[model samples]
Target: YTYNNRINRISIIQEHVMLRRAIERGVSTERLATALAINIAQVEKRLNLLDGICAETADLLKDRQCSADVFAVLRRMKPTRQIECAELMVSANNVTMAYARALMSASTPDRLVNAKRAPKPKGLSDEQLGLMQKEMSGLQDQYRMAEQTYGEDTLNRLLFVQEAKLLSAQALTVIAQVRFAKRQTSVDFGPSAGMR
Candidate 1:
């Protein structure tokens, strides 16, 4: 006899919680792998997904639709940097592993959680890294400014367009009234040819 089982898709947050609970309940990785019908490595990866993540960063990303790999990349950054990167990703509507890795690459050594284990640059020199850090700082400032002004700018544009439309309608109405009045005056006074 064969038994068919239906498995529901789980969110990243839910998976993390389940893995943590399983560990707390003295469940082994092998048991989790068997239960989930996944490989032992996959079970271990999910179990350690939030191992190095700070509470604040975890809370910030709890409701996000990002994958476990994205959180793994974020674990390389310090708490403050993690929060900043998470906020940036959320604001940009991007929560991909690539974006997280890019943020990690742009992070300075001091901003990383494990500065000693920082990835060595293959082709780029220290000077290039410094320049990149400065550029990233400038970009972050610009992003914040844009975020702050977005709503106000949108409202201003909407008001301007509405006012222009209102003015255009009023102008058209006035022009039509003027044309009607002129036609009436011309009729009352008789044709110019008749006057001549």
Candidate 2:
């Protein structure tokens, strides 16, 4: 739609695309900034919009109307956390910088890019955050295990159904053959067959 392409609905992403194209065409950054009427810093930032971002997260947000600051927030977390945050944003229809920061805040230190340098929440003590992190990690593990089990169960059920269908087809073929055999054996005798 015009809103997406021209009206900056997908602002940073569209700019990134244009910037990449210009860069590939050997356009200087200053020239690009002048052409786009933005500063060189912004032009460079747009060019590196997906620099540290994982492909999956970028794909998830490529079409959505997300704040550029959201990427800056996401870039702080590890790839897995970035993916989780992106999925949350997409599902909840909220891609503001605040939401991204909230998601980052909820993430365990281990999921951060530099766990040692990770920031703590304003209210929660380190001990409390650790406890919450453990609980969240446990829940994530349970979800992954359940998902694997469900996938295996589904595959087994499908294989069973396919086997059952094949058996049914074979049974039908055998029944048909038996009926033909019976008809062959029950052929009528000629009028003088008994006398012969």
Candidate 3:
């Protein structure tokens, strides 16, 4: 039965939990195996699995006694990510704003250092300057939205990890069901009718 497989997985997870508890309690493997109703070999398999896990994660999987510490460590290890596309767009937008500001500031021909007395190329027309300001504001809004979306994606990744753990737990249930089914006797309907 598939239950058998689930049973196996549950047993393994249980063994792992036991081994971790043993480590925390300073209990001997022999005692832990006895307590868990599993042989020493199985206990060792669980220990090996624990040995490979990182300290912070192992702590989380085990007793969860210091959740604050675990969270702090995770924060430190979190990646330093940047939104490249958004950054590029922001840079381009900044350049455009600067250009517009320069045009707006340019002195008229009457005031130009070189114009001495001629008119300037007509300092940025009011309409064009207003349009430039609007475009700059729009880009800034887009940049803000981009950052928000990136943060949301990071949250999604954390959720996915949690979901994976849930699925793994479900797998154990399925395996147990398989194991149980396999132990059942089925009647043969063809060729050997009523041979039970």
For TM-score, the strongest prediction is: 1
Off by over 4 Å in 1: 1-8, 188-196
lDDT of 1: 0.86
RMSD of each: 5.5, 7.6, 27.8
Q: Write the per-residue lDDT of candidate 1 for residues 60-88, one digit (tens) a residue.
A: 78877778889878888988999999889
Provide the overall lDDT of each model, using Cα atoms, as 2-decimal numbers.
0.86, 0.83, 0.49
Query: The CA-based lDDT of model 3 is what?
Result: 0.49
Candidate 2 residue-wise lDDT, 1-196, digit = tens: 5745556354567768877998999999999889879899988888888988999998899888777788989999999899988877886688899988777777877788987776677888878877777786576567667766997899999999999999999999999999999998898676887787
Off-target runs (Cα >4 Å) in candidate 2 are 2-8, 131-196
Top model by lDDT, which number?
1
Would you list the rank order by TM-score, best first? 1, 2, 3
TM-score of 2: 0.63
> Could you tell me which residue pairs clash in candidate 2?
none
Task: Decide which is better by TM-score, 2 or 3.
Answer: 2
